[model samples]
Target: MANIEQAATYYEVKKAEDVSRLISKYAGQGKTNKVIWLALIGVFIDAYDLTTLSFGIEQVITEFSLSPVMTGVVASAIICGTIAGNILGGWLTDKIGRYRVFMADMVLFVIAAIVAGLAPNVWVLIIARFIMGISVGIDLPVAMSYLTEFSRFNGRSNKAARLAAWCPMWYAASSVCFAVVLFLYFLLPEEYANWLWRVSLIFGAVPALLIIFIRGKYLTESPIWLANQGNLKEAVKILNESYNIPALTKIEYAQAVQIKPSHTGFAVLFNKTYLPRMIVSIVIHISVAFQYTTIAFFLPSILSRFFHTDTLTTISTTLGLNLLFAFTGGLLGVYIASRLTSRLVLIAGFAIQFLALLSLSLIGQPENSFLLYIAIIMLGLWLFAEGFGPGAQMMIYPTMAYPASIRGVGVGFNRAVSGVAQATALFLLPIWMAKYNTHVFLIISVFAIVPILVIGFLIKFEPTAVDVDAVVENDNIIKNLQHQISSQ
Candidate 1:
């Protein structure tokens, strides 16, 4: 009887320690800076792959002898594929795990890039581009989920900083790609122009390859995920290695075993407690979708229409502006987002975008050089605001609002919605711009204003600069506890 009692006591103590370690790991206090950087590298590659087509579109058209409408269709194809991929990827991330999804997606992107470069006809190019879009679409949600989950172990504020730094790396890569393409075009003969475009397509694969190796070398499964799976021992082990915590024994595990909120599906997002925030998140995403498609995707054509410049000059100028504004805005957005409320940053971004659009609409008539410069500067400011605000806001919202269990789904839903908006805008905006000119900008400006008011005035939650775990715990326990008790 004495021996049996002693064994039973030992088991109980061991179990308790296991639980304690699990909690610590899931709470995100144990991850290293190196883990964060590797994840960011994956995101950088994802961004580069997504933006590469914008620079390659002109060359694609000339090589294929395709019409402007066809070019729009090609661009729209990727966005459409991305929408589908985002939903699938989000589901898969939760189902399969982040590392698996991330690594696989990179391979898909690399394959798509190589195929796109080798395409013999326009249809093949379209197919390849669509596939590439799908891969990036998957990467965005999975990568963001990975970043959010891992960073949470450290702090949400750190996550914001990491995203701010890494997200703009995409724009920087796009700029570099454009410069390289231009140089290659100049260096190579017209007979080899198609080859240069092909080479550019293949270049999209490089970052993915680099990230794949890095991820393979260093990436670990999310500890939060491990806890959710009831694998406390493994979760604790990861925490020890990641955060430099000493090994936890069973006694610690039992003391720390508290049930966290479930975060697995669409239901988590639509739960009564999270519903209003969900609406706010959806609106923010839609607003960004509208703004991004109009400014980033359509700006070149708009310039061409207004300036009556040759295609090369229009593309070159647009690429230059994209590089400048995207980089500046990305960096600025990171800074402001880290310092201010995401809601305020978003409102400010829309306000800036609206003003820039209005200014461009009023002054951007044909052959108006002074107006052109004004438009460029204002647009740059607008992009800057987007980078600091919407870009960062998008990264923050789903992660902040959802618990770990359902975070992937929430982010995936948000990304998928944004992708749909982008696809639709790309398909329809060209026709509208051709018909209405400045009126198109005016219409987009009006849409941008509505969200600013709704988010600024109606929404009550503020997520900026808060402790991520504390916020999640408070939001989950206090707000949700109240919600549960009230519902009963």
Candidate 2:
């Protein structure tokens, strides 16, 4: 054992590092990137399937004779279901296994997509979308955990930096959804327009189904998670497959021996160590979801209303701008996140959102063509901040906010908070926008920003990739808990 330990130390100093130490080091390299890349497909599906409805919703409303309220419900149905999925799926991932959640969620996605594609009525479509939301809810926390863990294995200090892949992928998926809508709209005859929306909605299943097939071969248990379960052998295999590192020490397994293998309920979040993080995660996610979902999903319709443009022009411009600015925003968020603190990035993002919303309220219905151009410019700036800040960070923050012990639960809770915000936003946005004008609606969005700004500045901590144990020395809350545990 002594000789083996010495050899491991030698390898760490010069040759292949031990698997445990190097997991975060090799992120986005050979096998680690492959796993993360596969995991991102789940995020892509979630973003695409969930956001596509907004682009095609005008068509759905026309087809089903949906009132604004009904449209809101239909729009938010998946989010509502996702709220449940996030809670349940996170628990299951923490309790059962990551791979199991991955497999099960996609199956739900496939079935839900089929129902959505063939729905005979609005209620059926709502039910189908709700089911789809559940799948997304389950898929995200698990997939995000995989992505973060592998990226940490790549050896990046701040784990949130790895999430750069997440935002761009999300924007790309939304862009694809719009592109599909535009394609089907043009290809099909005027009489068959409803099919355009249906086909575009169902397109979510394709990538999901393909990724599902890949899970058995490419996907495996998260080594970080397995180590948590005290399964050294299985964890070692996964670590080797992920980064091609040598066998690891029994550090994780030995420590985990003391951990009870059961669900740590919501009560865990209330402990001194986790409380602030939980608060930050929940607030940032909800605020971002409310702002983005309401804005991004309704942009086309809002444009149609604002400029009084024809349907074709509105749809074309909507898709084009969402692609251009949103894609840019995603990239910016990633770049900024890698360099800046999360709190700083988040503050900047919300500030931009607030300014943009305030500007739109003030500019209400440009009197001339010049002001119209200005409104468009303001809209672009708002989106750019969104992509650079919340749009990108929402995914990153959830993964970073909690330790591996309850990552799934932590992220799921974030997702659940997001779902509540999403459902309320989706349900109320259209009705309120229609009731008051777009001007009032834009101003109302400012409300989400104030709280986010207050919270972002108060929380001074950031998440590192390793684990909670690694974080305890710096945080008084975690330190106190550690002291308590030792005393006990």
Candidate 3:
């Protein structure tokens, strides 16, 4: 299907710098918003799959006759799956291409959601959730890469703002999950109430399948990624399609005719330029995961036990908190990203969390309706701070910290650390809650305390409006830097 002139144009592109310049020229133009939204839909399903069990966890324990330990295992299975998925998916995204890996993970989402909903036993459910976790894990790195690569480096709706969008989408998914649970609570007969978890999980597949269908028509390869991999012609074509830029392949000449191999592997992330960012990202992600998993994942149960509320009331309260406070916080994060450093927001977030958790710990069990309302207010404050702070920064640091070459690995590694924290928190939370009741907030408060204390020291660089990838635009310098790092 290739004509002589068109085929010849593919070879006309010789310098990677020119490709980067062309992409930058039209960075915020054309179908960029549509492409970004399609990528964000992936984030929505990921958050939905991750939180599907939160509302129905008690039902799962009751239906399966599970012990505290088994309940923890079943609840944390998807998180455990993400640890593996993040590592493998990150590598594959960089090794292959973002579009291929992105498309493949969407399919996994469809399959895993279907299987999870139809699971026959606890073990089957666990397996299905684990598979779903992997899909989520794989999707995030690619999705984050898409978010970062597709947008401009600075100004309004820059990479940081775009990256922060994931948090609101994440809360949106959580709110939607709870809404579905509420609808099911009313729709299902009293006798069939236990089936709530199954149907809620199946709903996740609808969005995933819809994304798969729409993606084929709208999704294009990341031009930056293609250019990094030395595929200039394809990269320029995508630029033309997504950025409304004129095709550059027809140019008769180029600045230079040098080709550069892509820089990948986890080793580079530990080099002097990136190691600090990695440490900060991992610490914040893990801390956020520990706090979020114990609180958000167990919110329904926490409310049910603390207030002696029925299932319907617990679901409604959890839904309201997520929508009103948590989702609103996420939107605030998106709004402030263009104006504030992620570090400042994170510090504010962690400080508020520490105070909130400490207050909850001191309050103990609510002795009256007034105390109960106070406790709810504290919980809302924590979620609100988390929405804009750690939740948004956790993704921002890893995705923006590293350049395109190791961005996938950086985010994947950070996510894997968070996965471990989430698993540990989920596993220990029930045991802690049983022994300490509201005092368990004391233990959770430490996660918040540590991040506030350490974040200031660990993270010095601001990725908010910086072009981190351009730092390594010269291939020879990267090779020399890697050589120095390896030799040492």
Candidate 4:
């Protein structure tokens, strides 16, 4: 009986090692690319839902006869929900498991999208959008967690930084929406043009529903999460079967034993090791959320007001520049991410934005027609700059900054901060755009970049700094050493 029990223990540990090896192997072969693509689908939906209103704000306000304050509410509804979703989903993902959250949570998004598209009034639109926001919040952290845990860390191309793909994908989603809206602008008759916003909004539900369908069939929980929970049996099964790898034996069991079991709670984020990273994460997100929300979210409206452009030109132009600059900047980020520290990349990104905003503010409204062209160029510079630094890097930071134990919570918290910043910006922006001087907001935007730059300097994100497995192993070894010394 003793021998049998020992053998059983050996088998479980060996199974765990096989799981670990496959996870690493999958990372190297990019077998996990399917999961990454799935994650991008979620992000694309979020971005489309998020910035879609930027183009349709005028139409909504006109059709509904909404006040500036009411318009702000309409603009901010999804962001407000995102704040709540991030908090709730983050906690739930950590408390439950990534697989459940990843697969099931899209139901909320599906519902939210449909409700938002069919909203009958301003009140209904606000409420529907807020509900949709909740789904976005829930999905982002878990998706990012899945990416971070599954990605290979062989160091040639840091898997961690690929998380930056979120922004470009986000920009891509926005661009797609813009293109469709432009096409429909020509497709729909003038009498029915007012209904374009409704069509654009309802269209979001189609892809959203498609993601849920595909996820139901293929999505798996992160193996790291299973290992942390001490569910090595299922963990190994996913590695061998889902990931299509083989089980291992004695030598592999040693490595499998090194992974620590997971404990769900928010306590780990406050640990000294992660605390600074947390601060940096929150500050940069807050800054990004606040400033970017103000500048980018209303691009169509902003350009329309400044240059006195027609609706088609504004919508087409906003997404065009967003795609062009954001894509270029994203590639730049990906290329330099391995060579430069995250800090320097962030500073470089922010510096351009500050100068761009400063230039825009100093110029005041583009008085001459040619200067309006220059305004567009400056806008391109700011958007492009963001792609390389803050915009791309922000999504990657939260998951890697915390150990796997509290990653969901860490990401949720970071996004919640973003939600607040975005919500505040969304809420205040229309009011400001309506009543306040443009220069004031422009100055505020430039100043906002300062604290983020400060935080960037304070952080030095080590590629291996927060490896959950390594972190736990080192702690256990240290404790064992201290125990021996004290006992002697």
Candidate 5:
């Protein structure tokens, strides 16, 4: 009996090894390029739709006779809805699966786009935008989590960054939309102005339609999620199909031991083991959220106020900068993120943004075009820093830090909080910019400072090149070592 039990244990351990080897062998092949591309395209479409409204604001305001306050409310509605969507989508994805949730969200996005385009009044438009926001909001966190989980660590991180890199397509598409709006504005007589804006809103549906086909045909569910659910057979099958490996038998599947789920919750984030990292992530996200809304969404309005450029020029320049310069920032961030720790990159990025904002606040005054130009360039650089640094930081950190069981929830909570911060900033920044002007930069400067302090002093866990799972284990070892040293 003892001999039989010992043989059984040996067989189980060997089986687990064989299964791991088989999975890694296929994962090593890195054949997920096409899937990653399709996912990136999906993200691009979502980003484009979300950002397009910023460009359409002038048109919407003109046609609807909307006050600045009303415009802010309209913009804020989508963001608020997105917060709810993130939580709901995350829960659904964890409960159901990533592919199912993604497909459903795509349909929602398309329907919302139609409603928004056809909205007859401001109230209707606001409701449609809110729904649209929810759809995209759910899409971002889930899509990102799917990409990270499906990707193998070898060059997969870079590929994941590229998935986000395509986010500029959002700005590029918005730029084109701006161009189209400009053309229609000129081509059509004054009587058709309202129709022109409505057309642009309707046109937002194009990306969604394209993505629906792409996602339906190609998107694969996350194998990690499958493994965590104890569906080794399905997980292995996906690996075989995605990475082109030989099929495994039920016997092989039974040999694999179950992976215990990580106990992830909102409360877990505040636990002693995780609190510091959580704080750092929150501060970085908040700073990025605040700056992104102020710069990306509000910059054109601010530029128009300061430069007194024509509507076309303002829109064109805004589109151009976002597509060209902002995209550059995203790429630059990926490159930098590969070279350094996410925390370090985040720290440096925020530090640069702080200086840039301080310089702008000091020199940015009415009638100072030269300083304004400098400020714009610096602002782009600031965006580049965040785009390259904290952007990757947040995406990689949460995905890696949390356990498989609560990974979706952890990401959802982070996104929800970030969304709230962004929504508040989006609604208020414009009003503040119109009213406070220089004081706005001052406020941004203060927010930027918070992350630098958090990273430098408080953050103890640094997962630079470590696998996210390994990072959690290593963090435990570090804690034990610290305790021993202190006691000694």
Candidate 6:
């Protein structure tokens, strides 16, 4: 009886391994556009939703008669919601299945967007923003997982490159948001200016609805994730359906006693195998989030303060920087993803950001036209560096570093930390700028410096072209580790 049970286990494990290899072998050979769009459209929605309100927050404050503290709460409500969403989303994604979580979050976005657009009071608006934020937070982990699992390990269009594309999608979405606001600004009567923010926010639901409608056609449970979950039959079916792979799951005689039936929780991320990756991923993401939240989110305000610009100039300048510098930089990052290591690219990005911030500090509130121009250039340079470097690396690192079994949790935890940094920066930057002037640049420079020192000098690990998931999730490796542990 014991031998029969062991033989059955052996067959199951071998069949699962066959499914995994089949998916990896055929990953790059299929119709990839649907999968790519399905994963990335969420990122576009995230950036669009966040930016829609940026140009209209002053009006929201006036409409609601909000105090400073209440104003901060209203502004940051979404970010705070994301922190909780990241933790819970990642866990549920891994605990259940990717497709379920993916579809559910979009529903959340649609509902939240509509409610937010219709909210009549400050408290109601805050609740709506918070719910929308949870949707954003939940989408990221599953999105990154899809990007990583659906692509091959190395190529011009590898997993890293696909992940890099998210940064540009983000900036492109921001640019579109600004363009829409600018159009509405001119289209509306002076008496109806307050409706601009409400209308723009409701616009966010369009993409979410489209995604939800078409997602069933393109989105499928990740084959790699399925194989890991002991569902080889279904895993093989998805590979055949999504990847156009003619494959079969076959169980043969294998060492069944080596099978370790267990579950991986969040604590597994801190084991010796993953702690270093955890550190690197957390540091890179938090640093990028802080700097981006402080600068990109407040670009209009920052421009007005530094150059004493008018509303039109500030708006135009913000749109230009995002489209020209930030969006272009993201394209540059994607172009170089196949050519360079992610670590090297990250270090170079942080170095440029540090110098740009330092330059802005020395230049200090440009007094003349030439100095103001230089300051604006510095600002563009900072955003460009961000697009090409840490912005992409943050997604690339966690998605690639951890295996599929725990990829969601690892990426989720990393983003949650980043959300904390973002929330903190969002709350503090306005206060700091008012009190410290240009010295705030110096404080911001510290974020850039931390990544430069950590990734450049301390960590030697890089995820580019490396199959971290393949190695750690290998059945033979797991069997060997369990054997060693049992002998002890």
* Candidate that would win on TM-score: 3
lDDT tens digits, residues 42-69, model 1? 6766666666666566667777887758
Off by over 4 Å in 6: 1-13, 251-264, 473-488
lDDT of each prediction vs. the true structure? 0.69, 0.74, 0.84, 0.74, 0.68, 0.82
TM-score of 3: 0.92
Q: Could you give candidate 4's per-residue lDDT for residues 208-318 as a string of tens digits?
A: 788777875567788777766656666766665555545423444545555454545666778776788787878778878866776678788778886688887888788
Off by over 4 Å in 4: 1-31, 249-263, 446-448, 456-466, 475-488
Highest-scoring model, lDDT: 3
**lDDT by residue for model 6 (1-488), tens:** 11123223232225444554444444766655588888899999888888877777767878999766676787788888889889988998887878899899999999999999889998999999999889888999998988878887776678898899999999999998888788888999999989888988998999889988987777888877777777766776777777877655554422222333433478888988789988998889888887897679878778877678986787789999999899999999999987899999999999999999999999988889999999999999998998999886779999888878788898889889888888787778777877888888888999999987888878777877557655664656777899999999
Ten residues in sequence with the least summed lDDT for candidate 2: 9-18
Better of 4 and 6 by lDDT: 6
TM-score of 1: 0.86
Please, what is the TM-score per model? 0.86, 0.89, 0.92, 0.89, 0.86, 0.91
Q: Report the Cα lDDT for residue 17, model 6.
A: 46
Question: For model 5, what is the alpha-carbon lDDT of residue 449?
Answer: 90
Runs with alpha carbons beyond 4 Å of true place in candidate 1: 1-31, 67-69, 152-157, 247-263, 310-316, 465-477, 480-488
Clashing pairs in 3: none
- As a whole number from 0 to 100, the lDDT of residue 62 in candidate 2 is 87
User: Deviation in angstroms for 432 in model 6?
Assistant: 0.9
List model 3 lDDT by residue over 90-170, tens digit each. 998888878899889989999999999989899999999999999999999999998888887667888888999999999
lDDT of 5 by residue, 137-190 (tens): 788767776666555544435523543454354445556666767777788788
Residue 55's lDDT within candidate 6 is 73
- Model 1 lDDT on a 0 to 1 scale: 0.69
